[model samples]
Target: MAGGLVAGYVLGKLYLLLANRLRDHTVSIVMQFVATFLVWILGEQLGLSPIITVVVYALTIARVLPLRGEAWLRVQRYAVWDVVILVLNVLAFVLIGLQLRLSLPQLEGPNGRI
Candidate 1:
């Protein structure tokens, strides 16, 4: 997990540097999406906590992106990511609720000892 976190931070910096060189808006945004998934997938494949890896990667990228002074890209990226995060949060809660519903019966187990 720690290794994945470190790798994610490094990759995040690399992504920003790469993004800086791209002239096409569509391609740059696509690259950011790809890099985000790549970091998560690679981290999980390495037996690390992918969630933590993603969080670290996102934080690193977010911190550096605004410094580049790309107003259009900044606004666009922020809007897209904000919606993504909101949806993810809603989905997480729904999934957790479903999980709880599924597990409650087992917990009740004849006498509700649990």
Candidate 2:
């Protein structure tokens, strides 16, 4: 947990620094996505909560990235984030469905009853 939090903070700062140095908006957006994955995987490898790590990293970036970034970049970033949100929502629903499926047999009644 400690390692995850530290890595997340460093990752966000590194991404922000790179984004500020670079001239291309596309690269900056892509770098943010890459940093998110890196921090998430880092947290997983450290045996901690990847969600917490990613959230910290996102919160760090949220304060400045949108305000400093170009309007076009913001638009593209919004689109990308929208897709990510959709994918995560679908994945969560699928997980719930799977859990329901696993519990159904027990709920169907005991003693080999259908």
Which digits, one per residue and each the tens of the lDDT, describe model 1 over residues 1-114? 688779879888888888789877778777888998999898889888899989999999889788884789878877887998999999999999999989988877567677
Badly placed stretches (over 4 Å) of model 2 are 46-49, 110-114
TM-score of each model, in listed order? 0.72, 0.76
| lDDT string, candidate 2, 1-114, tens digits | 786677778777877887788678677668777778888998899887898889888888898888988888889889988999999999999999999999878776667665
Query: What TM-score would candidate 1 get against the native?
Result: 0.72
Residue range with the least summed lDDT across 10 consecutive positions in model 2: 105-114
Stretches off by above 4 angstroms in model 1 are: 46-52, 109-114
Cα lDDT, all candidates = 0.85, 0.83
